[model samples]
Target: MVHDILITKENPFENDVLNFRDHIHQFCSQFIFRKIPLSAVVGITGEWGTGKSTYLKMLQMHAEGKNKDVIYFNAWKYEFYEDPLIAIYFEMESKFKEVLTLKKYKKVLNDFKLYGTQFIKSVLINSISYVSEGIINLQDTKDNVKKIKEKQATLLEKRIEDLKGAKELVDRFSDSIATLAKIINENTDSPLIIIIDELDRCLPPHALKLLERIKHILSVPGVVFIIAYDKNQLSHSLKTLYGNDFNIEGYLIRIIDHEVAIPSLFSAEYFNKCADKVVLSNNIYIDKFDESYKGLNPFAVTNILMKLSLRDQQYIMHNIYSLNNKNKNITKISYLLVYFYFLGGLKLKNPSVFKLFESGTITKAEFYRKVLPALNPLERDEVIIGGAEILMAIVLTIISLIEGEQNPNNLTSLNLNGVNLEFNVHLVADVKTRMTTQRITNLKNIPKLYSEYPTFSLD
Candidate 1:
């Protein structure tokens, strides 16, 4: 039952071949504790589903062990709101409720609440007019003299100035932000680390607003922000929000102090480890297969795994484990199964070709032309491998089952392009003899192989 329950997500401490989690934690620690600048924005860049969020979780865990304050915020969770300032304000407030008693940080919390309300209101009411210089000719109408009326106008203008000058209003707003940052830093023992994840997942406006708000208004001395996203996506977002002429890289440079790319975690060693676990834990009899038949390019398989999420990885492994457990000789046909599962799972490639072939709607020549190239190319030295015969058997077995004829003897008699497929049929018969009816039925359904991994491609 080793494969019964796959690790749903990677553990922070689980070191892979790349030690990705450890490297992220180390970077966060070094950047946050720098002497000169107490506040910094660290950008963790990776394409979608490359596990940036998981790395942030590991960093949070490491920071917590050292008694540092960590605030994790998912921007996508509150993307429904028009204003990102509200999203950030509420997210911080929610986190504070869990960690610190409200009584101590009540004033600081209220400052955030008041400033957020005012900031939203200011954006909404964007056109406040300054006092005009024109004098009213109400000298005769008023009981007071003309000179007294003139003095009244000057006094009224001065009073209005005292109420709110444009510069004064902006300074007050900036002071409110500084107060909030100072109070939180002074109240907390360690520096506050804010991890903003899925920033790129937000809509173009929301993403740009969040970045702008963080860079301008919320930045403070004792706080550090780690923003996780795909740099390319965010750059595109900025261009969409701003014009095509926008200085995307320069704008990013102003916000992100240190940018680190998330490394590809699917090394050859890592995938081999995963394969060993799937095989041995499921009691799959892969050893009986000839070495050449079992051979596949690890690099190609690892590249396929890279395009998938951790969740997808777990799912495909579970399917393989279950299938191999049922059909003890499932490993014999795994060469094609691995490629077929991924191709069908992504569905970006041609899966219709397989369907046509299985239903006897396509010729063998058409199947070879359309489908074979999509599969991982075997090495030139391994041309004599029995994989081609096994592949043909797999196709014929499925074609027979889908046509309601599961008999191996009947399966071997299928004519492909006027040539007798006798040898391929025997290969199918040999493997089918070791499998149960249910196992063969499972293999008959090709979509079952694909249905588990989502058809959606991140690209």
Candidate 2:
């Protein structure tokens, strides 16, 4: 009989609760304790359902302990209709307004003499309209003067409508945060923190736009943005926008003045909390058996092992592959472990539960297929590459990135040496294709090996 591991902690990771606390503590210390608040832009990179949004929510809880006026937002499912920075600012102003009405913050609001309503309006309007004397006046319309007015009038009306709609949203956000910041600043005298969560699930294009928009967009200081993201997705995104010039390592450091990568290490105490909540509380495992979970990839091993009997625990734990593969030095098993860790975490949550059962216990296939190639799509876009399909599209885009965007016809067909292959091999090394296409002579003409096309992913 399968048993569900009960987790007592707030961890969304069904069974694995690791070193999230230290990460939160350290990140809070760096941003809150240090007053060096630059235009901090952080992108939380992770596969979808790595529980990044939950992690950010936890950070919001911790930030309160340090006297930061936290403004929390989930970009997923929201950034589609609205702009992110403007959305953030709107949230801030609203939070500020809310704080002003509180008895403790009322004095602060009065002292600053900040007319919350007006400040918010001006900020919103300023953000929306980039009107200059020349553009506003009849200056650049000498030739197409009549035509220019009609086009300009339509553009102006649309801009007005957009800004007006943004105004209502921003007004609410501004009122809440503006007053909140005023209150917090007045009451405790600390920098206000604005946390934007779920960049990975957010519209990637919108997220891409948000990164460009946030600098001048969120015109507030003393506001630290704790952006939670997974690096793999962030790199994938960076490659999409910046192309060959995408300097991911340098860019991450620059964007995040203070970056706190969810520490790779897992803590036993958090596990105790998890066991108390999920497994041990139900007496699924013996009291002493909890210690065996230590040193394993807290991301995967504990969750997988704890789900099975202690005997099965020994088997899964010993073979659990680490998903992280960027390091060339690590064993392939370790990297595969990272891959499985994420996939296992994924399975522990939702629909793919049966897939794990279908793949059989670890004894079935070890070398040929590391993790089961389920090819399942996640509900949330895989931050790793949005989702598999988006990732495929992005890979297609990058295929052209290596070969310039100018040519659209030959995209599907990759040439080996001088000639176009008999059939354009859209995707390669498909284990299914290997078996099916082995008999076909034309398969040799198509690109297959990673050695041939060094630029292809799997890097």
Candidate 3:
């Protein structure tokens, strides 16, 4: 019973997993449909795989259920276009055709295409001018190129005219959208909710261009935008376009009327539920492993999973299944599970450190410095300071076993050449209680055990 590593984009509201349905409903009914201003841009900010896409889907579902017109635009999907406006225009055109008759939709959108073409042409002509400026200057005195400059001079005059008409083009485009929105509003009795999703996944240039177009052209009455993104990642994209010193918050404030942070989905109960979903088989070893670790603090596992993004959590869970399957013969199933879980987390969070640790080149001090800091504050506190006795026991037992120690039941400390790493007395006791003497003796090849699990790339 192998589970797929990726979670399907099924409507979580139907099942109400993670209890997000109430939050989604409240946000849609209270804020989005009722209180939010028409033509407002609402930003839904969260890290990647923190369920931004899922939340947006739920919002769209809820909004449509309430008879609101919703258009979901995935910007990253159509980012290959030279201009974001072109992609946006086509999406609106497609959606508008659904509500209005084909003739009426064509009539309303005719002016939009006319002005949109002019606007796009103006941008292209300007780019050509900028790129060919140097060559034009260098070839100015050549008799062969003099006519080219004269033609370009005439075209520059026309470009000046096009520049003057730029404002008109923008206004017509806006008017077309407003008219469509009004028709939709008249039919649905609600403003059109345009959800722009995956903006953070776009290339930096495309992302910034999309933001600018949204702010300038798409800001109109009778239309509201809900943009989902990872704020930090979008900030990085902005910094890549602008300098690192650019004020991202200031720029976003001008575009977004409201900012909504997706709530954290971390909890012990939720973690256990997700774990159960991945570890579906009722193998005797798995049952024994669960029973043995039932006394272990839930945070011990939760801390590791919570450190990963939601997507990475799924991957590690899948990895856990693989690890458990490969090491089913091992008697210390609980210890192996915890060890592999921590390793999978380390692999995802810091591949470089994981590589070093995997190569057996990382010392204990290096692990303390690199791996400990790689963990989040809660993970560090739990896995190092509080409720870390089991983890520490696993680490010490593995180290002692690898160093040719037959039974580490009484092993309290290790001398790593000059460095002394002490183990907690309780950790040794816990290890002894969980693992038999024979189990420790048999689990000599820690690296070999790790080798049984497949290697994977984060990318």
Best by TM-score: 3
Over 150-267, each residue of candidate 3 has an lDDT whose tens digit, in order, gives: 7677777776786778778788878878887777777776778899998998999999889889988998877888899998899999998799998999999998988988777654
RMSD of every candidate to native, in Å, equals 9.5, 17.4, 5.5
What value of lDDT does candidate 3 attain over all alpha carbons? Answer: 0.66
Question: What TM-score against the true fold does each predicted structure earn?
Answer: 0.61, 0.47, 0.77
The C-alpha stretches of model 3 lying farther than 4 A from their native spots are 1-12, 35-37, 101-127, 130-138, 142-153, 281-306, 321-332, 350-356, 361-374, 377-389, 404-407, 410-459
Clash counts per candidate, in order, are 0, 41, 0
Q: Which is superior by lDDT, 1 or 3?
A: 3
Alpha-carbon lDDT of model 1:
0.58
**Residues 1-459, model 1: lDDT tens digits:** 123212223344554433565586668557643332366788999876566776777777666665556788889988987677766766666765566566966776666566656766765454333223324444346575776668767867776775575345445555655555455556554456889998998899888888988887667666788899987888888888788888878988999988888875644454445556766565553333445444334223424423454445544555666655554444455534543444333343455764664344544456457655555443333321243334456555554554556574554443333333233445566555644344544555444444544333322
Tens-digit per-residue lDDT, 1-459, candidate 2 = 113333333442344454366666666666655553233555444444344554676677656655556778877746754545546545755776665565766654543334444444554555544455233555554777877678678777877986796666544443444444443555656567777776755555787766555543442455556677777776777687679678878866655655555644324444345334433333333223123222233332334322322222322222221101222221222222233333333343433442433343222232114323333322231221112222222223222322323333343332222222221233222212222422322222111211122221110
- Stronger candidate by lDDT (1 vs 2): 1
What TM-score does candidate 1 get on C-alpha atoms? 0.61
